[model samples]
Target: MAEKYCVENLAVSVLDNLRYQHDWTELQILTHSPVDDLPLPRPLISGLPPRRLYLHPDDQIEMLKSHPNPEGSIPETPVTEWVLPVHLAEKWTLKAFASVFDSMPPENSASPHRVKRVLLATVHDDSTVVYYFMHDGIVKPRQN
Candidate 1:
C-alpha cells in the first residue's frame, strides 16, 4: 500500500530545509495541527522571537481599546507558523479565512505556544507570501 501523506510530515520536511538554509540558532516546531478540526488541508506551527509571522486585526483593536495610555504602551503579540499544504494552489475564500480565524485563540488567552501573534508564510515555487494573524478586534492597517 502507498504511504498516506501526512501534513505533519510535510511541515517537518519544510522546517528541516529552512533550518539548513538559515542556520537559525534556535528553531522550534510549534503546533503540528490546528486547534480546531477545520476541513482545510494544512497544519500550523508557531514559535518565539527573532522573527514574527502573523497578527490578527481584531487583536490590534482590542489592544488599542484596553490600553490605559496610548502614547506609552506596547502589546505583546504571539507569533505562530501556518503550514499550508504543498499541493494547494488557488485563491483563498471567506469560508476558508473564517475557519482559520475561528481556530486561533485571543491574545489574552494562554496558549501552550504562548504566541500572541501568528505568521502565515505561503511557500510557492520560488517565492513566499506571508500573512499575519492578529488576536481579535480592529486596528489601523499598517501602511504597506
Candidate 2:
C-alpha cells in the first residue's frame, strides 16, 4: 500500500543521512523486532556511531578513577544503537514509544546495565533528518 511505501522511503532517507552524512557504520534496516520476531510499527535502523553518543555518569566516574589521565587516554568505544525513523508530521505518544522500547533487542553484553535508549530520527519534508535521544526511563542528567 501507499502507507508502507511512504514508511520505507522515510526509513531509507534516514538511513542514508546517517550513513553518508554522519559517518555511522554497520547500518541496517530492521523490519522485525529482534525480541519477539514480530513486525515493528515502522522500520528501525541499527548502527554504530562514529563516536560515543552518551556516557553514564557512574561509568564516567569509574573511568576517571581507573585512568591516571582521563583526558585523552580513555578510549571511548561506540556502542550500537537502535534508531526509529518517522516523518516529522507523524503523531507520537508515550504508549507508542513504550511499544518500540519493549520490542527492542537486548543491549550488547558489554554494557548490560546501560539504560535502553533510541535515536528518534525524524525526517522533514525538505529532506532533512533530525535525531534526538529517547530513553526508556529518566536518566540522570549528564554532569558538565
Candidate 3:
C-alpha cells in the first residue's frame, strides 16, 4: 500500500504541536527534503533554538581531554540528541525516517569537525525509541 504521508510532513505535523503547546517563539521551517540522501517527501525542519538543544557524547570526551583542570574528573556532557516534539498517533516508516536523516550535516559546529548531533525523537507516550545514524568526521566505534 502506498504511504499516505511522507516524513517531512509528519515532522511538521508534530511541529504544529510545538508551536501551540510550548509557545516557542520564532518557529521556522528549515527543510523539507531528506537531511541527506534518502527518499521521503516531507519538509525537514529546524528552528534557531531559544538555546542549543543537544550535545554529542564524543564531543564531550574530546572536551574533557582538552580541559586544563588538574583533577580531570571527566566532566559530564549530555549525550547529543535533537529535541524534536512528536506525537503518538502518527505512524512513520524507514523511508520517511531516511528523509529526515539525509537533511542534517554530519558534523556539528562546536568543535569544527569533532562534534555532531543526531535527531532523537520521542513519541508523546515517551516509551519507544526511534534512532537515526549521524556522523561527524568518521569515528571509530568502541569495543565492548
Which one wins on TM-score?
2
For all the candidates, what are their Cα RMSDs to the real structure? Answer: 6.7, 2.8, 6.7
Overall local distance difference test of candidate 2: 0.82
* Per-residue C-alpha lDDT of model 1 across residues 81-142, encoded as one tens digit per residue: 44333323446665665565556544334645333334444445444433344432344565
Candidate lDDT values, in order: 0.47, 0.82, 0.46
> What lDDT tens digits, residue by residue, belong to model 3 across residues 10-126?
566545644565444455544432234543244444444344344345655666668899365544433333334334466666665555455554445444342244444444443
The best candidate by lDDT is 2
Model 3 residue 95 lDDT?
Answer: 63
- Which residue pairs overlap in candidate 2's backbone? none
Error of 2 at 14 (Å): 0.6
- lDDT over C-alpha atoms for residue 47 of model 1: 37
Runs of candidate 2 with Cα error greater than 4 angstroms are 1-5, 71-73, 109-115
Candidate 3: lDDT of 2?
A: 51
lDDT of 2 at 142: 65
